[model samples]
Target: MKKGENTRKHIISKAAELFNQKGYAGSSMSDITELTGIKKGGIYRHFASKDEIALEAYNYAGSIVGGHIQEAIRQQETAFGKLLSYLRVYVNVVEEPPFIGGCPLLNAAVECDDGHPILRQRAQQGLEGTLGNIKAIIMQGIESGEFKADIDVDALATFTLSIMEGSVMMSKLEGDNRHVRMNIENFSAYLRAVCVQN
Candidate 1:
């Protein structure tokens, strides 16, 4: 990569964790500089404003989590296994997060809901993408005769995502992983019960 590209990526990597942890509104230019060891001029030369950086940082963080989940899903052979792998990723996140903070989508959605339109839209896209993935898995399972045909894919995907996100929030707030594990265990059971017998 070129020098400028490297510098830009460096800024995004450093700022992603800060934004995910402190949030867009909470993380300041000085914080970015401190974290990245880049001066205000350096950061500005790459990003026009903090909002630009925040958006990129949010994308970067989301991509990391997304990549990890995709990899995990790929490791499973069956659709039911893939779905469980998806949930397992988040359960693991509650114990050992891939990034510094928790789920970037949840954080950005909560923090940017009222103020930052761009960030909120980005978060919305991330969430929609996640729902799409889950829906695809459910559809695949149905086609393969692994899941019931009558299942509501859209509603189930939304509910599953909601449960995972809620579990993450609760775990983060209480600094405990028990509730997250419990939720995942229950979700796994639900998946097993819903799966068609071979």
Candidate 2:
């Protein structure tokens, strides 16, 4: 890549790690300069302010997490397979996180809530996109006769999202992967319960 472009990418990447781990408000321009090893003027030349960096960093972090789910689900033909693949991403994340910190959406939601409006919106956008993907899969199953016709699409999708994100929070809090494994098992059974069963 070109020099400026490479620098911009590096700043976003390192800033993503800093903001994600340190929280947006918790991180400062000097902190970014220090972490990025870029001078204040050098950083300013690339980004207008910390707000711009936070937005870009969140998007950068979000793309990694979102890309994994989309990529995994795309590998499956059936809705159940797709859904299972989505769950597996969470399980896989316990071992291989998508980025420097854990799930950006989860971290952003927690850190950005009630403040940091831009980051909050970005996180919300990421979540809505994910929920839409999950709901679309459920809808596809309904149309394809894979899932039950009477399945509560929104409820199931919401439950799956809650389970995934909540389990991630608990697992991270306790520093244990078993929480994810156990939740994945129960959620997997829940998925089976919603299927046509024949």
Candidate 3:
């Protein structure tokens, strides 16, 4: 990468960790500069404003997490396996988060809920893509005869995301991956029994 583009990405990477952990509202330009070891002028030179930096950081964080999950899911051989692999990512995230704070989507969604319309929209768009991936996996299972044809794809996808996100939250709070592991295992087994083919 060019020197300028490299500097821009460096700012985004550091800011993403800061904003993900401290939140956009909580993190300030001072904090960003301290974390990135760059002067305010240096940062502003690359980003028009803090908002621009935050948006780029959010996108970077999302892609980091998404790529991790997508790579894992791709390793699976069947649609049912892919669905289980998808849920398993959260279990891994409980301890080894792709970013410093945690799940960027969850953090952004909660932090942006009442304010930061642009960031909230970014979170929403990221979540829709996530849910859409789940639905697509379910549809693939049905088409491949790997999953029961009668499954309600929409409801299952929504429920899966909700429960998985909730589990991650609990795990983060307690500083233990056991809760997430149990939840993922039980849910995966349940789906295997009822949804997956014999």
Candidate 4:
């Protein structure tokens, strides 16, 4: 990458960390500048405003978490395994220090609310993609006779997402991953309950 691109990425990465920790409204350009060790002019050269930086940061964070889950789901051959992989990846993320910041989409969604239109939209898109992936796995399971036909995949996906995000939020707020693990266990239970006998 060019020097300019590298600097821009550096700014976005640092901004993402800050935005994840302190939130959009709570974060400032000065914070980004200080954390990235980039001067004000350098920051302005990359991003027009803090809002733009926050939006890009939020998008980057979402992509990071979402991509991890997608890869995990795709790697498993069976629907049951995929579901388990989906839930397990979160636990793994929590175990890893880097992704331990919790769900970035959840963090941005909660922080943005109705305030940040662009960031909120990106967050919503990220969540919709997540829920859709889970729902697809459930649908595949049902089609394969591994899950009951009567199961509400959409509702189950939504519920599972809620539980997962909630658990991550709680765990991060409390500085522990125990709650996240418990929530993943509960998701596994929910999956088993919905799965049909082969």
Angstrom error at residue 44, model 1: 0.7
What is the overall TM-score of model 4 with all chains considered together?
0.90
lDDT (tens digit, per residue) of candidate 2 on 1-198? 899999999999999999878888889888988988999999989989889988899899888877887888889999888876656777745567666677888899999899888888888898898889889999999999888898888898888888888877787777777777888788778778656446
- State the local distance difference test value for candidate 1: 0.87
Clashes of each: 0, 0, 0, 0
Q: What's the TM-score of every candidate structure?
A: 0.95, 0.93, 0.95, 0.90
lDDT of 1 by residue, 4-119 (tens): 99999999999999999888888889999999999999999999999999989999999998888899888998887787665577675655886679889999999999899988
Off by over 4 Å in 2: 92-95
Ranking by lDDT: 1, 3, 2, 4
Comparing 2 with 4 on lDDT, the higher-scoring candidate is: 2
Candidate 1 clash pair list: none
C-alpha lDDT score of every prediction, in listed order: 0.87, 0.83, 0.86, 0.78
Score candidate 2 by TM-score against the native: 0.93
Q: Estimate the overall C-alpha local distance difference test score of candidate 3.
A: 0.86
Off by over 4 Å in 1: 195-198
